[model samples]
Target: MREAYLASGLTLSDLSVQVPLAKSKLSELLRGIGLYPRWEIVSRLAALLRLPHVPLYRLWRQAAFEAHKSREWVERSTDNTTALTTSPAAPPLDHRAFCELVEADYLLYAQTFLIDDTACHNAVGDTFDILWLTWNEALASPDTRSYAWTMLRRTIMSRTPHIDGRPHFTHAAFDTAALTHLTDEQARADHLTETIALFQVMGWLPPTQLDVTVLRILWRMPTERVSELMGVPPALVRSSQHHAEHFLKSALYPTDNEGRTP
Candidate 1:
């Protein structure tokens, strides 16, 4: 919201007049220093910034949910759901082109993080809608692809269930055929232990290294494609992959340091 406000080149005083919100309260909203503003305020600000209200409303609802607002309260707050859902602001052509370019890879990334098919689709769809709402700010960023990818990652992480402050990998572990097909209870338990340990290690990796390892190793995409998707140079992608490999080896096999079992 702040980014879009900045990109709009509108002064607070002008926004005060336009949004009819007090300068102090508007500052709080922009800086995220106060309680979540009412949706009416957010919707008006989005309109003044030339942003569509649908996605912004969705974001507001998400924030409210995270703030522990009940589903009933959220539903009751919506006076006209049909109008918000059917808002007529179409995405720009460039935005559509960008979506076409990266849609497949976005789905793959979301699917890997969220094992549920329905959740994956919703994640990607919400991401695109968000990108649409903030397209101008995204274009102003250093790398739009990187900006969008970061948004996608955050969306998936927010939806992913966690255990003990870490992402729960039990569902992801079952995807491995070797672990899933084990009929013997003892063998199945052993494979699950190993698989979950690997996933835990992967989860602990820095974001860049984790993404590089997933795209390059798990998805088997070429280096050039990974570079394009990540909005980083090919050299950086290769370097991240190398670092991820070393980190995984060290993390998963600390007992065998320097190829010698301790």
Candidate 2:
């Protein structure tokens, strides 16, 4: 469709006169970045492109069938895991059920590491689109779940902007700034508060370290998996994680002037 549209020298906007579809919407279908389109829209697009409708419809059906099979594979693969591997593609389902089953997991994870609601949604949205388009590949290999998971991580790392690490808050700084209370209850509250604050502050870290820490350290993904996602060596993934851990420890749990827990 894309090739035909280009070859015809008619922009999607120009073709919109002949078909009742939005140019951008057509692009989504042509790119396969979105869910299935209505038959009328598909037929219109094929006709406008001077392509035979039946063959194009058959192609759509084949992709949809593969997408459905992959959805079943994902559901089965996810049923056995603690954290849902973030693959966005699934066969169309009841809207409420879709959110409960698929969208919630990624949203929760995104909220945990991102700075705000916009960042959270934006962080997960691109991955969602990519997965929605290509997640069927998950069913092809023996390491089905792992392959799906690696794709998810790579999606995140690829889309997010990099942050260069500079000196930032460490745990020791916070400890000195706030005197520890005498009671155990106060101590626990302070601990919980600081731990959460530390997580939010991750948004300010180098994006690479943030990716490394979230994938390699917090998620406990294998170094090789993180490496593949970040497009770096496994050793560097480990090293980035190591440095990220050290930075967080210093920022979230500062020691006293005497080198003791305050």
Q: Pick the candidate with the highest lDDT.
A: 1
Tens-place lDDT digits, model 1, residues 1-262: 8987988899899889866579999999999988766676776777777677766777788778879988887776675333323345677889999999999988887766797887888788889888988787789999998899888888888888776666655567777758767899999988889877888888877788888887887678899999998889999999999999888889899877777885
lDDT of 2 by residue, 1-262 (tens): 6766776788878877866677888788788778666556665666666554433444454445546746554344335423212322243243224334435445544543344567556545544444333334444555433454455556445444444533232332233223444357777667657655765567566766876776665556678755654457778877888888877877766784349976
Q: Which stretches of candidate 2 lie over 4 Å from their true place?
A: 1-9, 21-129, 132-188, 228-231, 253-262
lDDT of 1: 0.81
Question: How far does residue 201 in candidate 2 sit from its true spot (Å)?
Answer: 2.3
Note the clash tally of each candidate: 0, 9
Scored against the true structure, residue 209 in model 1 reaches a CA lDDT of 89
Worst 10 residues of 2 by lDDT: 80-89
RMSD of each: 3.7, 13.3
Candidate 1 wrong stretches, greater than 4 Å: 9-13, 18-21, 75-88, 115-119, 140-142, 158-171, 181-184
Best by TM-score: 1
